[model samples]
Target: MAKANVKTVEKAVEKVVNLPAGEKIERDGGEVTALDAASIRLVMQGWEIRKKIDELDAQLKSINAQLIEAHGAGASLVVHGVCRASIAEREAVKITNAERLKAVLGFRFTDLVKTEIAYKPEAKLIEMAADGDEPMAPSIRECLTVGKSASVTWRAEK
Candidate 1:
């Protein structure tokens, strides 16, 4: 795995030390003389922030997996229903629409499911949602509708 270029406590301290004089170097012991000491607080804070980010990433991955599974199951049910409706009612048009839906919402969705989904490209749906409009699937299906757009918040869903 690729490591992040994080500024550790030591690095932070080094930065402060390297800076020209006339700048304040406040520390708990009434001002720090060494770079290592200066970095102590900053390093701890950075570590905490990194830990939180890792935890959030794990949670997000789990949620994305669940969403992908749910979407897959939903697609399967829809497909089965379309097959049954087509056979019983002989509604070829409905079958065609169902096939299209499967291709778009089911098959296409799998490709989009991932650990992180960004939605900047799906500005239309976001805009609609911001405008107090209900953002349904088909409305935003064209733009990164799968994993790329899956990382949405509870507020966005509501």
Candidate 2:
């Protein structure tokens, strides 16, 4: 039993290591290649759970699509001892381009849409700060601490 478990774990580790992107994770100073076993195990567990969820979600979506196709739009389905599923419709009012609408509407745009001044970081200034060189270096340092977070696109297929 222990041997089988160890082999299973080894295969999991091999699979993760064989992957191009997920092998080394980034740390404060640089990428860390040698991760602890517990950390790796936790990540593997999360991956396994997410894979199962993705499979279930795909199946649910396909089944829902079938139901919608069979019933057409704005319909419902009831399964005995189960539940009711809906393809109910609702109107969504969306202003995709508020700037264009404001330009075209002139004054009446205010009635429909509320506007506010939004301050956003400029990329060049951030780059200058990162490179430790610029006229805006002091200002960028004072005003902003530019940082990045992980962005994940799940690979559904192994």
Candidate 3:
């Protein structure tokens, strides 16, 4: 019986060895061969996985494009204020025009959609002398002191 089993195995090996590497071996019984069936399924599964990955890649690219567009339209401002507290200090240049300030704040200057300014004195005081004229407010000096930082937000005009 051992010899017979060895002969049967030898015949099976001989039958497979002559055919191409990937070609299926003929069988009489209703049974599936592992290698042939697995290769076909692998090919099909790989195509499906590639298709899904392509769809996801397209979606990611669209989202990134939108983010780039939004970032271009809006940006953050960093205002650095330098303070010089000296007995004799040069006058501070007040930024009165909204359009000019807006240009200074951003790389690309454009007309302002709206302008607003909040100050402690609540008035735009140029200068004064002796007499009953109101003395210059300390806050005005503070505002003029360069290096003293403050940030004002404004919408960019379309």
TM agreement with the true structure for every prediction? 0.27, 0.46, 0.25
Q: Model 3: which ten-residue window has the lowest total lDDT? A: 82-91
Which should have the higher TM-score, number 1 or number 2? 2
After superposition, the stretches of candidate 1 with alpha carbons farther than 4 Å from their true spots are 1-33, 36-38, 73-158
User: Which regions of candidate 2 deviate over 4 angstroms?
Assistant: 1-26, 31-33, 96-100, 116-158
lDDT of 3 by residue, 1-158 (tens): 99999999998777656544343445776554545544655666788999999999898666545544544323443233532111211333443443433444353222212234531111233231112354433433433323222222333332
lDDT of 1 by residue, 1-158 (tens): 12334546557667666654433467665774544444555666788999999999999778656655555322222233232111111111111132333354465433333223321322333343235444345433433222323332232111
For each candidate, the alpha-carbon lDDT, in order, equals: 0.42, 0.56, 0.43
The global Cα lDDT (0 to 1) of model 1 is: 0.42
lDDT for residue 70 in candidate 3, whole number 0-100: 49
Among these predicted structures, which one has the highest lDDT? 2
N/CA/C clash count, model 1: 3
| Alpha-carbon runs more than 4 Å astray in model 3 | 1-35, 73-158
Report the lDDT tens digits of candidate 2 across residue range 44-158: 8899999999999898777866766677656655665556676644432233444544454457445534445633334443455456555544544454444422211222231
Per-model root-mean-square deviation over C-alphas: 20.0, 18.0, 23.5
